[model samples]
Target: MALFRTSIRVFHSSTRKMTTSSVTRAPFLLSPNQVSELTNSGHTHSVSLLDSTWFMPNSPRNAKDEFLSKRIRGAQFLDLDEVASSHELGLKHMMPDSQTFARACEKLGISPSTHVIIYDSHGVFSSPRALFMFRSFGHENSSIIDGGLPRWVDEGHPLDTAAPILPEPGTYGLPNLKEGAIKNYDDIVANSQHDPATNGHVELVLDARPKGRYTGTDPEPRPGLSSGHIPHSYSLTFNLFLQKHKTKTGQEYSTFLPPSEIKAALDNAVGTAEANQIINGQRPVVTSCGSGMTAGVLWLGLQLLGVKQVGLYDESWTGYSMRPTSQIQKTS
Candidate 1:
């Protein structure tokens, strides 16, 4: 029993620190000052070449940063959109398989310990989604650079336009099997009616789709998926918290967000008109979306906030939206 207890502690410790290496991460992300220490002499380690909302367009390229022509030296470029969808059109940019992720990270020179920050050409569209994905996939040390590239460029920070050189690929070894931090449709369904056989508690479901889609006002972006949200799930668009676009230019990608600012976005969202949930202390979250892909983003945020006992509604709106109205929400 003593041996078993020690082994269990090690397992718990690993899960807790899954996103980190020997390097310690600022809890979630503190004020920008916390990481300002990263600027030793003049350099950032593991920078992202994202174009999140804050990047400025002092020149024509600044608009939407659509070209990503002004990236930081040594930064890795992970496409803000379609990293997952490029191959499996079925999953709307859901977390790609481990092998696929490995290849992409390898191509980008990301490692288990890389400090990842995702920004978009627009302040809000896809960067937060990517940051959330990294967390769920177990890169705990990652952070969103505050204000992203626009802020940096506006500050007259240096930008590099050269194509990124490749680094030796690092292992992106996410397991294929669902583990402690993931869940599927049946898991939700079996527990939907509050079954005592499993005697396990079903989690609170969170829908990351647009409010219009959550309430059936908007058609799903993907074809054939049903329109409504899952039973008990509430809608909250990740983009609502993203920074506004500075221009109408085509979208490219840049890098980073301020942790304090992102935290504020989340804080203001609780029970607000833009967001539909009032997450306090109770009711552990189970994130969901049209096809279970974006839901992972929501799940990722909750994990960052230190919510334990969370899971993903794997089928999300797609599987449940197709169900007969009578079967949508099962009551005990």
Candidate 2:
């Protein structure tokens, strides 16, 4: 009996260690100060800072044009619409397969060993989505710059106006991608509804669109797609996680609110019990929004609140709304 018990103990101990390593926690978000510190500490070589700004088709200012004109010194651009997305027509900004993703990272001098730091021109918009892409690709040493370029400039950091000197192409090989870090329509479809078998392990679908969009009342910015959110998903606008601040020059910009405020907002969106389950890591959360851009905002907010099992619905409502078989719900 003693020998049998000893074997059981060893098995459980080894299992725990494996589980711990599998879910390694690196810093989720970094301030501009920390990024500057790392640069000054002679750590620039291993770090790949990404400018992952994106704009809607109707937006007047082009993200790429803005990057070429002015960007954080030593920041490479991650083209979400062109490089990292699926090649399929009309599926805007969907996550590419592993090989395509590896190639894109390689072009940007990002190898598996690279420490990626993402930020966007818009304070807290698309960088977290880029971070999600990197993490889903199994690159563990990834983080987002808090407040992004707007805050960086507000703090009097230097910007590079000249053309970027691209680094030598990196040898980013195939990675052990984390399947659970991104969810497809099928996964959300399967897991959105509650079931007794998945009592404690349910995946909560969270919509990051505005209340009007969530309720099918607002017209979708993208043409030809139906309005309304996925069934069993809660309406939580991505902007709720952001707080606007004015600079010394009287320019206004948005930045992430403190974790406490974020937690309160999330708790209100999803009920207290469900939010607690998600925060305690008992349940998973999947975030989605129009064309998968603002979904990152919610994904980052949840990460700030220390929720681990969170994912981005890469296709978001763009694909869901157009699908003939899918069902959408609206609340009055």
Candidate 3:
């Protein structure tokens, strides 16, 4: 009943001007008073993350025992079993095409107005890919459930075994371009050279790739790519932040180190690099890794810490390697 009212309010409010923040945040986060007001004004629809599918079984799931024996309410399972393609695009499970995104959304009853939140069994890799798809489409307020469903189940949330029912997908009311909050490949290179404060809001350029890759000691994931880290990018591989012991009193939640702990780790890395930037500089941080994939894990972590200007370098190494003449500093 409350959701239905909110949906009506959103429709009415759409007749007036809409701010970027209004569309980008989950609907429930909006004040209840504000939501009621929108409903009173006659908005037609409101969207929430509860509508999207959650893919909890990705590459880095816990040992079979630690896996999600229980589930979250309203979640639908999406397996990575033999990768399928949409139409004849001929892509793989790892790199889904735009058409594949549209079809998947349809299969799950996601319209342009539906707020979709994605998460996977793997900590970072698969969820970022789904987040990228939400950005590609015009859906607003799309986010990956950080730390995936394992965290949710560990905390003893309600589980729903019965699968959700879906109505036919409606026509997409997607915007032409600005509909999604995504940065392009070229934009990444241009921003790498820009001053984050003066030119734009840039969070730190943290690299979530392995130290070997960041220091030029390893080959890249994609074929025919030069091996090295991006200039001025700091390394913070996905493995380091994830604590292994859920039972230990000191460290739990596998990922998301408390800020005090993260501060010390960042300080050590910054000192090693000889960069004297503030230990807790309040810059919005962007993360990069091979082909712009792993970096999403870091961005999601920073977002958990309440940093507002988080983003991913969509092209990442793919863009850096393409540069004709670029610097490749091998940090000690």
For each candidate in turn, the TM-score is 0.62, 0.87, 0.57
User: By summed lDDT, which 10 consecutive residues of candidate 3 come out lowest?
Assistant: 5-14
lDDT of each: 0.49, 0.79, 0.49
Once superposed on the true structure, which residue ranges of model 2 sit more than 4 Å away at CA? 1-26, 85-89, 192-201
For model 1, how does the per-residue alpha-carbon lDDT over 196-303 read when each residue is reduced to its tens digit?
Answer: 223324455666778777776666765665566555545566553344433233333322223345455555544432122323445445666665545644554554
RMSD of each: 9.2, 7.9, 8.7
Compose the digit string of candidate 3's lDDT tens values, residues 182-300: 45455556556754435434435777778887887786665666777665567878665444435223324343455455555655554422222332334545667765556655655
Q: Please identify which of the two predictions, 1 or 3, would achieve the higher lDDT against the true structure.
A: 1
> In candidate 2, which residue pairs clash?
none
List residue ranges in candidate 3 displaced over 4 A.
1-24, 27-104, 112-115, 132-143, 149-167, 176-185, 188-204, 221-224, 245-253, 259-285, 322-326
Winner by lDDT between candidate 2 and candidate 1: 2
Candidate closest to the true structure, highest lDDT = 2
In order of lDDT, best first, we have 2, 1, 3
